[model samples]
Target chain A: MVNDNILGIIAGILTSLAMLPQLLKVLKEKNVDDLSPLMLITLILGLSLWVWYGVFKRELPIIYSNAFAVLVNLSLLSCYFLYRKSG
Target chain B: MVNDNILGIIAGILTSLAMLPQLLKVLKEKNVDDLSPLMLITLILGLSLWVWYGVFKRELPIIYSNAFAVLVNLSLLSCYFLYRKSG
Candidate 1:
């Protein structure tokens, strides 16, 4: 059986880490130009739901990771918007 | 109060949708070159955890979203590895 505490911690770190490639790609390429609006909009909604689910469950890992994901998504979205506006 | 069923459905759609940006960006840019292995590794772990969390809560949204997210992550990771190998 998996240790619940360790699993939660590992899950948190990994989930957050998953954002890195997108973050790095956006940062390195500076080309959020092709990112879709529907995608971002949907993701934000999803993240919002995850956050709500976390709160309902009182699970810190879900709460923290999804919250952080919202920020990452927002940041990426903002960059995408900026790219569009500038272009 | 929000309808839990509706919320779960919305959450599932949103979470899955969230992966679109990354998918599109990777697709368009064809540059998973800079993606980090540690990040991919961590994300898989997190996604797995989220899936478990979903199972525990009996939440369809979490299950579907995280499952989809895992595929998205794996696809991206495979591309990154290919990029790394090629260059």
Candidate 2:
């Protein structure tokens, strides 16, 4: 049987890394028309909560994943505005 | 101090609901030119793992949030293909 935390770690890593492709795309294309600001805002908010929850639960995987997610989402959010303004 | 599970629940709800506007926009606009198929695919995979993690942990909030998220992401994925094909 698979360990649950191991699964969680894998899930967390994938989920966090999932932002890379989109971020890179946006950076390369310099377009944010398809990315919704509201979605980014809500995602950041949700990710913040996840970080806090992980902290409270003493779950390192959860904390690490969400913490990194917050950074990636923040980068995307900033890029959205930056690219939109410049483009 | 705030309850961790409460935070988790709220995070889950927001994260799950975060997909709504994008999905709605895609459905109404019938255009997915900006959406990345690779991102959608990875998101679905990550969400699936999260669902399994929730199940192993027996965390209802995680399960519910991720399960709903899976459906929403799947819808987005299908819409990506459908609209891509149609448009």
Clashing pairs in 2: none
Instruction: Find the candidate with the highest lDDT and give its number.
Output: 2
- Model 1 earns a TM-score of 0.75
Off by over 4 Å in 2: none
Each candidate's DockQ: 0.58, 0.72
> B1-87 in candidate 1: lDDT tens per residue?
776657767887767766667767777777875567778878877888978867766767778878888888888888787666563
**lDDT digits (tens) for residues B41-67 of candidate 2:** 787898899889988877777788888
Candidate 2 global TM-score: 0.89
In model 2, state the lDDT of residue A16: 70
Which candidate has the top score in TM-score?
A: 2
Instruction: List the candidates' TM-scores in order.
Output: 0.75, 0.89
